[model samples]
Target: MTRHGEDIGRWLATQRRDWDRLNEEQQARLGKLGVKKAARARKAPAKAATASRQGKGGEAFQKGLEALTQYLARESRMPGRAAVQEMPDGDIRRVGVWLANQKQRRDRLHPDQLAALAHLGADWAR
Candidate 1:
């Protein structure tokens, strides 16, 4: 089911994952909906999933870095939010949109990712 265009399944999954952080009233409300807290014994698997996701994030960051570097090499400056770059492998990456997203999500970025962006002269990354 969906609410406000967001999938209830995904929302419930998040709620389960963060169940321990929820207030008593919130937990009770979810309990009424038949949602239970995440299993404590499952933490090891959760950590493994997080590691897998971080690995993928690292790969994506590398691709974004490649796109940005290629753009900079050709243009001598960062691309604007509307700029798109054709990667060497023929993949068209929206480098500008990626950069803009990075800036907006800078606070959530890994320290290494932020460092890479800062090294590339993205002031917002700092």
Candidate 2:
């Protein structure tokens, strides 16, 4: 079988057993064939897939997911909501760690001050 066919064969195997059994040459063949097949599959619906993939750029993804809607009077344009939603837990904790480190740099922070600054953010060697 071509590389793509080998990949399908490997996937069809029970518990990845077939993958473990393939020689390096066979694995390469499978990869080539699998990629060709994937290309063909993607070619048929490329536009929509491209459009969506373009949206998944991590921090760049606008994810305009709104927090709320509010009424605006004729005299006043609706102002953006002032209430900030809770930041992602991971980001909140990471920022805390970064701040702690920054405060401890001896040039930035004295050795005597490190222990007190430790929990504030970045770790500075005393």
Candidate 3:
């Protein structure tokens, strides 16, 4: 069962399409097997809310997933907890600037992020 799960995970992580996670060609082939993708989804793997979002595009994703997870977790949170990272270099830079501009070491966070940071104050200080 674990191996079957791994196979499914592996297949989903190397998608190449820009807007659609599984390309039209692959969907057509799968459709022949009577497993057509639901029309409700047209966005790519990056847009999907699953493990594929953590693995698509290879090593970079894994490294990023690690760093953000490490940064956001509270000591009491379990290792497998989900994390929402503030990625995109531009965004990170913007956040840094915002943080710096606020002058108060604890100010300038997005409301939700501020709440999260408060919840993990011990981790943040470290």
Best-to-worst order by TM-score is: 1, 3, 2
The candidate that wins on lDDT is: 1
Residue 2 shift from truth in candidate 3, angstroms: 5.8
How many collisions per candidate?
0, 14, 1
Q: Give the per-residue lDDT digits (tens) of candidate 3, residues 1-126.
A: 237457653443323222266778887776576664434434344234332333443343334334444544523352232333355453332222332332244322233343444444424422
Badly placed stretches (over 4 Å) of model 3 are 1-19, 39-126
* Pairs of colliding residues, candidate 3: 21-44
TM-score of 3: 0.22
lDDT per model vs. reference:
0.83, 0.35, 0.40
| Tens-digit lDDT string for candidate 1 (19-100) | 9889999999989988899875544564455445757776887899999999999999989999999997999999999999
Q: Model 2 over residues 13-119: C-alpha lDDT tens digits?
A: 42233455567777678667652222122333543443355454312212211111111221133223332323334221222223333443233332333444333
Which scores better on TM-score, 1 or 2? Answer: 1
lDDT of 1 at 75: 95
Comparison by TM-score, 2 against 3, better one: 3
